[model samples]
Target: MRRTTAAIAIIAISVPTVPLTYGRSQVGGARVKQYQEHLRTVLPEADHFVSKGGEYPHFRGYIRGTAGEVDKLVGLAYLNSDVGHAITGYASEIVVMVGLRPVGTITAVTVVTHNEPYGYRSIDLARFKNQFPNRR
Candidate 1:
């Protein structure tokens, strides 16, 4: 009886630990390293010149455009069926807003809005908000 209990405890502990060890080796470490290198390469060129204070740090002088200029602004699409299943009821569509300063410099990112049924109440305006003073 004692041996069985010991074995059960050992299995419980090892099961969670296996993911911590194997998962890190598989992709987590490599993904983190890649992101760090990517961020290092992109930070210098992006300009942040917002003087107005707010809940979050203002990232101004990034992309120059207005709210209606959705087509002109770059869009990043994450088309993962698994993510679709997890968040929304159907695996049809998912739109997440991410704040981008330049090609590589991402200052702040928040989920603006989603077509999903149940999620955040109000969209975060900051995600799509950009102040570009130099654009024509």
Candidate 2:
């Protein structure tokens, strides 16, 4: 039974399930605008952006329009986080919003939210996010 359960779990995860906004309660429409604003800090050249597709565990699909329809793509943006906590010990999810170039390199990453220790958060946000603009 254990082996069967494990196999089922693996198959369930391996199969590409059409992401139905995993945890709909967690991702709201507001996060779309939030991520778009975050994306602008990295992709000012995109000109137009829209997040209309479903959200996944770490991926958000969006439409990018640049230099007219000829240059277009249904880009997948990433919003992820490192786990940390405040002094009180509650889990604080740090959400990092990021976009990728067509070649699969990171274009930019913005730290969107966190509940880190006050002092550490105050200084680390900018420096940490600044590193991912052109990384792969």
Candidate 3:
């Protein structure tokens, strides 16, 4: 009985300790839909937009679309978890890959204010603006 009680207590204690991770779905299906809607509004001429599973952290999806930009491609992604936590308020390095090559990069990543954690200070947008231009 003691062992069972101790086990339950241990599990309860560890539950909250486990970090929360957000994926494309974690952002909420409605939010993802909203983002897609916003993207469509911003890039109305896009040929098409597709979403796929991401490879790291809390990344939920990899969005690809074609607009009138030089590269004609843009990506939208979401991160949730410790990896997300680290980059929550800052823009981290993002490499945009083209057919077997990296084409452009986004620098000074900043978290969208709506996604910011409660009680934490706001991050400077200028601090996380684009830093990398086109790189081979």
Candidate 4:
């Protein structure tokens, strides 16, 4: 048997609305719920989130952190980030495939992905991520 899963992130981008492929409305409620549960785990400071669209032509999600203790907002987007290696030569063709792409606020500097060697923990602690959130 084959298994499949869906992820959702509440992002704040001004791009035009995109369509979702898994059907709209209550049809994929289960997957949305699942995404919410997992997002809560990854972003415990988040109070709640809102998602846009239902399929992949331009599916996106977003959440705000207003619990006082949390200082960042979250969004879902699909990105084709270039990946490089310490020993291997840098190549633009080497792209990081993201399954669940999480980026911080409007000007947010944080991002999350499932690529190896990208080092999520270290990246999270990097100084660059501390930049001010986008106010747009």
Q: For this target, which candidate reaches the highest TM-score against the unseen true structure?
A: 2
Q: Candidate 3: deviation at residue 136, Å?
A: 8.1
lDDT of 4 by residue, 68-101 (tens): 7643445443223312232221221222212233
Predicted structure 3: lDDT: 0.38
Compare candidates 3 and 4 on lDDT and give the better one. Answer: 3
Encode model 2's per-residue lDDT on 18-88: one tens digit a residue. 43332333344544554567756655556555444343433334445456556455344655531222123
- lDDT tens readout by residue for model 3, 1-136: 9999999999999986653333334334444454454334333444444444445422122334348534344443333332333332334432221111123332113333344433456544344333422322
Q: Per-residue CA lDDT of candidate 1, range 1-136, in tens? A: 9999999999998876453211222242343342332222223343222222222322223344467652232322121221233234243334332234435444433332255344455433444434321222
Residue 44 in model 3: lDDT: 41
The better-scoring model by TM-score among 1 and 2 is 2
Model 3 spans with C-alpha error above 4 angstroms: 1-22, 26-32, 37-47, 54-85, 88-104, 107-110, 114-122, 132-136
In terms of lDDT, the poorest run of 10 residues in model 3 is 93-102
| Structure candidate 1, residue pairs in collision | none
Q: Candidate 2: where is the Cα deviation over 4 Å?
A: 1-31, 52-71, 81-91, 120-123
Q: Which stretches of candidate 4 lie over 4 Å from their true place?
A: 1-28, 37-47, 54-110, 116-125
Query: Which residue pairs come into collision in candidate 2?
Result: none
| Alpha-carbon shift of residue 27 in model 2 (angstroms) | 8.7
Model 3, residue 38: distance off in Å is 6.9
RMSD of each: 14.2, 9.9, 9.1, 14.0
> What C-alpha lDDT does candidate 2 achieve relative to the native structure?
0.56
